[model samples]
Target: MTSGSGVWITLEGGDGSGKTTQSDLLADWLTEAGRTVVRTREPGGSEVGQLIRDIVLHHRGDIAPRAEALLYAADRAHHVATVVRPALARGEVVLQDRYLDSSVAYQGAGRVLDGDEIRNLSLWAAEGALPDLTVLLDLDPESARVRLDAADKPFDRLEAEKTEFHARVRDSYLALAEAEPERFLVLDASASPEAIAAQIRDRVATLVG
Candidate 1:
């Protein structure tokens, strides 16, 4: 559970899987329902984290897998300490775009590191803070690629990785969900935005009220 008396929800998925769209809709719905919502994303959620994010996501050259993982952990430590915990303490719903799960999926399974080690490191960074709910937008790698290409945006470091890397990430996410069924809500990313948002809202309703 999170550090305070508020809901902490995380949205997770491969890139271009509609997490931002769903997050926006969820934030709007929660705010309309008279809840104090704090919208944040890990790896760039704080000032220090922004710098770390630049290295991990946009650096022109390669970063060692362990070094990359450490950067993410550092950002997680600062972001949670400065941004997430404070919002939770204020009784605000934290609608975050990503969390430690991203590290376990991308750096762990995708990079062939020990998933358990990555998860343990992330837990240490956040002091074992876990989300009240994790909404996983599940999508195939090819579909995600098509979506990304359609957006016509420059690929970030992680996004520019090979399709096989993304496939591993998707599998790892599903495995994590399977291991922690109660904390996860897995939804097909192929669903229409409105439909996905509706499912998310239904699940969130049970958590928030």
Candidate 2:
């Protein structure tokens, strides 16, 4: 059973940064600690989000950056309303694989959108439901590319973007962490999964203390 006051946590990173593995490990740790947890991912949590995700990620046709951003925002709005908020209200610890930071990093930084505009759109979509904590898995772009190359599926639109775009996204995430030191935890992606999970556990324990 879950409590009625959940903690929201988000995991963020570029493709091949191992965010999925880290998020899963952290969720397992929380469950072992007797906490109810909901592990979800952006752009595909809700039914609507899944449809939009297919379009955004797999569509071969070119889409404008702003349009892409808007679709991401729309998926987020549905995710929060139907999934995240409900779980949080029930006090289930929410460990999301990615959230608004993905939009800001991939859309704003990677696409060169106006930062202020992206921020405004995000604020509106999220309705101030910011994560209680955000984990940023920092990795070298080159290393990330290698990992992606070995992945099961072919790259999507955002993942297919050039290395320079990924560099921008990484820089933007780092900058975001700097701006919100209290809520952001920067982890070394080069670390083993166990080591990264340990770091996440330490932070969550401190927060829950």
Q: Which candidate comes out best when scored by lDDT?
A: 1
lDDT of each: 0.95, 0.88
Cα lDDT of model 2 by residue, 167-191, tens digit: 9999999998999999999999999
Model 2: what TM-score? 0.95
Model 2 lDDT at residue 24: 77
Residue 163's lDDT in candidate 1: 94
lDDT of 2 at 29: 80
Root-mean-square deviation of Cα positions for candidate 1 versus the true structure, in angstroms = 0.9
* Candidate 1 lowest-lDDT run of ten: 1-10
On residues 1-209, what C-alpha lDDT tens digit does candidate 1 reach at each position? 55467899999999989999999999999999999999999889998999999899999988999999999999999998898888988889999998989999999999999999999999998899889999999999999999999999899999999999999999999999999999999999999999999999999999889
